[model samples]
Target: MLPALALAVAVTVTAPPAAHARTGPAPSAAKASKTAKFPPGFLWGVATSGFQGEGSFPDSNWTRYVKRKATGISDPYEKSVDFLHRYPGDIKLARNLGANVFRTSIEWARIEPRPGVRDPKAIAYYDDLIRRIRAAGMRPMITLDHWVYPGWVADQGAWDNPKTQADWLRNARFIVDRYKHQGVIWITFNEASAYMYKELTMRPMDLGQLAAMRTAIVKTHRAAYDMIHKIDPGAPVSTNVAYGTALNGIFDAALFNEVTDKIDFIGIDYYYGANAENLTAGYALTGEFWKIDPEPEGLYYVLKSYQRRLPKLPVYVVENGMSTDNGKPRPDGYTRSDHLRDHIYWIQRAMADGVKMIGYNYWSLTDNYEWGSYRPRFGLYTVDALTDPSLARRPTDAVATYRSIIANRGVPSGYVPVRRPGWCSVEDPVATCFGTTPTPPAAYRIPAR
Candidate 1:
């Protein structure tokens, strides 16, 4: 989940008009044709986090936080989708999607439920999970940490504690050494920026504590990156950044700039887009993600920005998806299939524009506890986590669309995004609003409604 407060801050900051003056015409139709197809072996995958998708709650900071009535969570964390016991069936759903990569986090809380003791049962569970993923013909992309930590860490002042860095690296090194030979892609931390924002929201903290936490997070990631490379040698590792609108650079610089040399690739999670006219994004602050319009075209600008910043590193859309409130139909009638295709269309455009994009993962495989609520469903398969005791995984409209996409490598040759690019999109003001208007091939444009 992205921090809506960050988006609110981005809305107030705008680039100067002259800073992005167009110097030439947009790409020609002929150029688009040359890059319509995805390169061979592009990674098509689904993403889930340990705490968000997995059920059977363990003692963790999040579990404790949600217990407080003041948190105002819409629902209780009732064995969320029960992924702890049902991973095999979920893995089957991803396999049926033709996915080559299955991304999930190794829960620090579960692995080390206590201060220093490691649970063998937790280790065995993840061992089998990775084995199944590999046997099903997919590589496992493991996230070492995804915001939730052992309750012991929280009791010790969480990231603000100076001891937290060593403790984090201890668990991280163990996980890396255990799975180093398993053909795994590693993510050191999930949305490091959002994690910090969540800390601010979940609890009251002074600026000094926040700064300490930031420093500790950077040090922990740097150490973890070094340790993973030392153990695995050539495996790719990154800490994904949640893409904030105009404040993206600022938010990313908080941690990314500190360890730019440590990253093997750039992992980005993009959801909503904001522009001068698109104030609807404010709804995300209140957990109303569906009300915010989907802006698939903004993904193109996001990729282009990163390509310009880090020309050599491969970029991956580590997580991207739209959320509907409690699986309800969006008022705009934009189905999940439409959102998936439109986002892929923009990704193809980014690739055409020379961005070194290598992989894309839908946000999740099934609906689970999205932070504090199950209301925001961002899954290819919807699961009634609160109501259904069976916790059945029902396919949404995106299932067939994703299966065909992975099998075909991308959307068809003449595909255009269902959602057109907004005027002066804040995603990359210099590239969009202030610069030359991007024009798709005439064959790809759909008539305005």
Candidate 2:
């Protein structure tokens, strides 16, 4: 997930040439017909992380970070959504969406609060969580690390310490051995680049320390991939990348490139997009994600780019969603339902164009603590983690839209996007705008319902 804090990293923006203007009529109904169906057995799911969604967090780097009153956290981390206790009901909510997958992470801090000490209670909690997810007829996609480490680990310099690799592997082996029989898909790391960036944001790191942390992340992912496969043969494992628009190649080179041979699938987490006409992604610099315009059509280009690079591996959209300010209506009048449908439309288009797309998990099931703030809401069911006493999971407009999409395996046949494709998308400017990329079926906009 993109960090909900000011990002110091610079984005490389490429200005498209003037000749790339969108032209031509909408594709014939015959061409657009292919966008209505998905391949059989595509996984549909919702995603949440241990630190972000599951509250009652154990002693970890994040818990410690939030404790610093100057972090500018919008709301105190008060048992965020309390998924630690409310997971049963949450699982039922996901199952109701007709989803076949449920993605989440195991809190390393909770499981191993001390060096070499394993918490039985934490193990039991995760065991029941996985069992309940399976009972609800959804496959569990478990992430080994979601950017939080045991406070003890932090006391010893976190990932900058060379010994941390062994500790991380030990935890990975334990989790894999315990859950291998639960039919769980494994995610070795979540948004490794973003993880590194978040670490830098919290505390400045020297170049050597940054290098050490990067090496640790790469080595551990490669090691974890092998260990997971050995424990659960044929199990799929990947480290999802937070898709960085024009700098994707450079950002991925840090960790993703090192373990290309190890990943079973290409996991991508795409949110905002940039182009000549749309540059609102800058809002994320100040953690104002809701102000960023979502370019759903850019998903098609992102998938295409990955398919070109690693044609053998299937692509799974591990996270994708639009945020709203405190669950309020968007100024652009773009509802969650509209955003969901538009993104799915592009996914289908990508599949139709022969990208080996396998699955897509919405960013979250309910609004939880987004790194440091509760202001950027990205959930099908909105929960007021800061203001509401009961922490109710109020269904957003996207709930029914998602249920319908899953039931039919895609959007309705004649449905058109509420938002038109942006001109000269930075996701893949050369291919999407300049190169001989075939023109997309021209969009026919319909009033958002």
Candidate 3:
């Protein structure tokens, strides 16, 4: 195992080079004519979270954070996309897109509201959701926690209190016991490192307390992993990692390295990648997520790095998507379909290189409350929950593109990416600068799975 590094701002990006220098790989004199296909049984899906999508405000850490008027950076917590009431329609949307898997969370704050008092109605809501997803011919991927805890848990010293873990497990056991038979994949925690980073930076805490909190999270993950296995031994389980740009190793040290052994498959959530000359990642320092550019090829390095590190585990891209401000076209002019195609191209490349790639899930099925704002939109189906009264699901251009990709088993061989690879991608500096760019195979076409 690698030694843990100091926790810095999550965006510890390296210096970027001049923009003109990195236009992507120079065109090869020769080009391949056949497109490669993903392996048989490769899972394709869309992802959503309970607190982000479920509306009608629940009392929890996030709701409290948004309510604190002193935080000028916060946005008003109006009802989110209302997935709580409209999930049936949404599940149908996912099925229409040819998705084989559907990922969403069981909001801890909602399911077990008010400490030791599990809400029957909340349980019934999820029971129906699981059934609906299966009815649509998609398997459910349920995340136990996605960074929100009951306000009551916050009062009990959050993760700082050891008793919180016990309370969490009691809730976990109940959830797993109920949904294990639905052929669900389990994510013990969503972006564990990001959860801790928010707790450490958004709130006050000493280094000692921070360390204790991390330990508690690992204990909880391991305990839940064991409990879920006891209930459904064949179920796949993991905690997704928010892959930091070139600084992923530094971020992994904060949490992932601790509970690696407990993971049945590696779950990666990749979003941004910084090029050598365009260290535009500096924008993240201001905490504006909309400012970051989408780096589709970065997903390749993320999978390759983990493939080398954890050779035995199959990898799943639990979350990957582009976020446009308010569902608008990017100033850089990248389209969602363009981003999706480029990313898929690289995913096929990685798999060909022997990575045990198993699945890929777009970050969301619909836009929801993104942390504190609705500005960073990362959905194939856009929902203006704040401005629109009806909360309609609007399909973006990527919808047809995704459905086509899923139907073909991948992008067609000989299909060129609309967005070329970034010049000097810091994703893997050595390879980006000195190695030959990988090209599609000329004669080999992957058969549709």
Candidate 4:
């Protein structure tokens, strides 16, 4: 299976760049205001993941994936951002920037390292993390799953087996019961559909394997949703799904239709590019990440698509930022400041068009693993994990710019975003703003008469 997956990874890595690329805690932070009028409630937060940012945890599937030769991720999962120890430092950094919410995930693999045994130490770690959230005056948004699972569970049956859903429910119930008092945002799963296919596509899976994965994902999400509400009836639960280009949205729809009745809110994650060929209902998307370049106008199109369908629920720029291979200025002498400023301009335009929008969370405060390498840097505070020894976090030009945006409540009227907004490629990839280059839709074919 892994050898075949290695071949798949080789294929994707070799493919043309199409498109690419959440959280923790309240130091304590929801509704964003409407156009011109901010919502009655607004959520301002930064996001992280336990497996990605938390260091010093025991081995899990991702840990193995990172270490494996085919997976290609470096550094072997040691002391990632040292957030396990220095989250306070990062949380403090977010607080200083005027953020009102901190988002992070609970690693099930860590919380339930062994099948039946719960880790007391892991529970304590999260207890401390939640307490810190309340202390920081930020609301906590806890994600139940963020694409990492226990190595043991993987051994038993990943999503391909029926038992995985039951196992997941056990863990979900434990989490909701344990953290009920946090009054936090409950995210049942983070980009489940996206991860499932990406993982399978990463390895190669037959239709039967694909069917099992899809079935298990929907069932698992539904089970977890019920568990969250059953344990804490009032807790608002949602699933944060990746709302990417056509390909990503199609993959993210698994839980949307199957478990629509089980959620309080649907969290949609939107990143770079402006193509709207494949949005699904019941699951509203949060602009996960957007930049001024490569696809600045794509951000505008993203909000516009939501306005057309998800107009009532305010949009949250859940994640958005830029990545420089070498921390250099943007192509047009655009600094990080230009990138953010430009994206905000389209955000304002979206607001004018009556998009119920709320908060905007930066992609990250510091750079970590870009899945495989340190080359793809995306943080307001840059970490030299690849080149710098101190692992120190340093601010970029956008740090001050973001502080100003949070303080001012919006970008200035005269402030020009780095680029102009462009048309959305609903059924065409090459029809995008930055995508003026014509590439036919992947699924294009003539229908029978």
Candidate 5:
């Protein structure tokens, strides 16, 4: 177990602390009367994007990042993970673990790189992928846009110009119409706000460009939702908004929130929370490159924060995980499984307190691309993007842990942690003591570069 570096913030209300309560009626009556399973009929799965794992066929915003060498990407944009070929093995990987649901994206750049020219070849590829997922006996969750846009569209001013909305919908409508039969869950965009940073900053974010990009995403999401429902009334359509600072632009959540009434289940992707220090550094809290706070309580507070604003909807923790290079041991010898166990315990704790968190999806099934570098590994099945031509996927210990949890429907009874994390305080819904204690300057996090 790792030793927690404690930090604190002042609270406006000096309130009493809260505790985690077990759910269900009493065990004697609970077994007979328990309304929900430990997972409580909630789904469990993982998420991946087309460009990140699907590998190369065309250039888009992401390929530009690699070719221009904005960050350190050495490969020739070759089929890196080659999930294009390995999805059968990958979906099999998912099913073996008993994961009932899996989320992946439909890359627009691949399907519609040219104006009015739909790529039958690329559509056929996804057609095959969706069919395989059902064959695996797992529900497919599809993300219409996972950050990559067609290269030609990028040249047409990208998100800076509102014209991108028309192009985005063309691709969105094409995908939903083609694959609606899968009985799948639909997420219109991957993480709109975080991409505003990616589209701007990796290209670099200026205030003007950032604002325009955010607007385009909201407009794009609404258009996609309408088009999807139009095609398949049975398809539950929605978009996954990656929660950014203060649980997604505290005030600006309305950009995505406006369409809440139109969505089915909310896919809320939470990688990490931004304490005041993280915001000062200027990186969007999209990927789990840094362990901002490894405490499970942060998960509970974030889930509820969104719930208060978007109540009457069941929330799914769509994407969550820690990134490790080579799965190296953590500061005090914590392994990946420890991270999984702690975070999930907090998830169950959230369920106990009635957050209505419907599912848990790990960030990825295989280590693929992380923006421009292969250094940040978030997959349960690690793929070393360097020195391995086979693109062989290997499973980590966390897989077995997760498999058992899924198979048994919950963590084993009487299971306890090696140490109690300090952030546990946040899980208490009433006392959500944010920044309630003084954090030492020396302990300020050295975030991922």
Candidate 6:
């Protein structure tokens, strides 16, 4: 599996360029009011994960994958941004940015290193981290699993084993019981389909093995949701879906639909969007990290589509941000601040149209190990963990912009987008090809679909 994936990655690098743009009708002006506002008590935050940000890694599947010979020419995962030791300072940076929520994963590998054996020291570490988040005037948004698990669990056939599910619930129940009083939002799993894809691609998993893993994940999520509410009745629980442009409908049918009723709210992590003309997102599929095109307005279409699909549940942008090549400016000259403001404009646009949107968390507070490489920087503050010895967190252009956005609740009323809506956006093709006039208060379906 590893060698095959390596060859696939090699093909992407050598393959001829894909058609990333298309000619279409002239771009249309967004129909949102200039003074649109988000709903009251909306969450504004930044997100990070343990394996990506935290330096010290436990012996989990990802570490083994990285160490494997077939990975070929990837950067060594050296103390990734050192979030484990520097979280206090980093949390302070987030607080100073005027963010009201800070998202991080409580790594299952660290908390329960061995089956039925809890790590008191690891538990205490989270205790302090959660308190620091609240002390800094920010609410904690904890993710139970962010694609990493205990090494022991991995040895037991991963999700394919019945014991894996039992072990997962045991750990999840303990987490619910321990952190119920924190008054936090819960994420059962992050990017479920993405996780499955990675697992199947890198590990030697047959179709049956893949099916078993996915089934176990959904079962674990449903059980976790019930357990969380049993501890905190008012707690909102969800497993964030990574909304793929033109592919979300399939993603929803495959994994998201089963847990819809179990989820209290919908969590979406949308980063890249494609259209008839622009397929720069093709780069993402082929491992071309530098070839992304930003389409902030596409976020509006994503929120609206989900809002229509799940009218009763509120939606939160659990993770959204732009990535640049190795912390450098884009050749297109789009800045980080520009991406943030433009995306927020669409969020407000969706809200004004009655999408029941509630929250937005930037992809990360500081750049860390982006899965296999640190080259795709997606942080309000850039940290060069690979080269910089001090690992200093340097503020970027987005910091001041985010600070003001949070302080004002959103962008100013008269603010127009940095870029206009793209033509026939595949993010929501039916809506974009037709029109985006706000749906009536009594109705929230995509128009002309």
Candidate 6 lDDT, tens digit per residue, 1-449? Answer: 34234323322322231222322332233443633676567788999999999977878878777777223227778699999999999999999988888999999898988878888988898889999999998889999999888888889889989888888888888887888787788998898867776776666577677667767887888888888898878988998998776555545543577788998888999887877657777666655556777777788767777777688999999999988889888776778998899888888877876778778899889998877788889989999988899999999999999999988889987666666555578865555566543324233111111
Summarize candidate 5's per-residue lDDT along 229-269 as a digit string, tens digits: 88877777776776544333432342455567777777776
Worst 10 residues of 6 by lDDT: 440-449
Candidates in order: C-alpha RMSD to true structure: 3.7, 4.5, 6.1, 10.0, 7.9, 7.3
lDDT scores in order = 0.80, 0.81, 0.78, 0.63, 0.66, 0.78
List candidate 3 segments past 4 Å from native.
1-35, 70-73, 436-449
| Candidate 4 lDDT by residue in tens digits, 1-449 | 34323323423312232232100110000112122423445676677778777777676767767667333444555776677787778888888888787778899898988889889988898899988887988888888888888988878867777788888888888888888867688887777655664455443456567666666777777777777777787877777656555444444444554565666654656555533432321121211122223445456556665445444454666667777765665445656776676666667766665666766667777776655456566888888775666778899988898888777767765443344333434323333423432222332121000
* Per-residue lDDT of candidate 2, residues 83-162 (tens digit): 99999999999999999899999988999998889999999999999999999998999999999899999999888888
Report clashes for each candidate as comma-separated counts: 1, 0, 6, 34, 9, 4
Q: What is the lDDT of residue 417 in candidate 6?
A: 67
Which regions of candidate 6 fall more than 4 Å away from where they truly are? 1-35, 69-73, 434-449
The reply for model 4, stretches above 4 Å from the true place, is: 1-40, 72-75, 201-204, 274-292, 310-312, 427-449
Regions more than 4 Å wrong, model 1? 1-34, 70-72, 434-449
Off by over 4 Å in 2: 1-33, 70-72, 435-449
Tell me the TM-score of model 5: 0.82
Lowest lDDT sum, 10 consecutive residues, model 5, at: 1-10
Q: List, residue by residue over 1-449, the lDDT tens digit for candidate 3.
A: 11113344322232221122232343221255323488667799999999898888678888888887423236676789989899999999999999999999998898877978889899899999999999999999999999889999999999889999999999999899998777899998888767776676555456667677777887899999999999988999999998877556656755677777989999999877787545666555455666776666677777777877789999999998888888888776778887798788878767766678889999889998888778889899999877899999999999999999898888876666655455566776666776565544442221000
Query: What is the descending lDDT order?
Result: 2, 1, 3, 6, 5, 4
Query: C-alpha displacement of 75 in model 1, angstroms?
Result: 1.3
Instruction: Write out the backbone clash pairs for model 5.
Output: 8-437, 9-435, 9-436, 9-437, 37-40, 200-204, 200-205, 201-204, 201-205
How would you encode candidate 1's per-residue C-alpha lDDT over 45-86 as one tens digit per residue? Answer: 999989888877789888887887335466788688888999
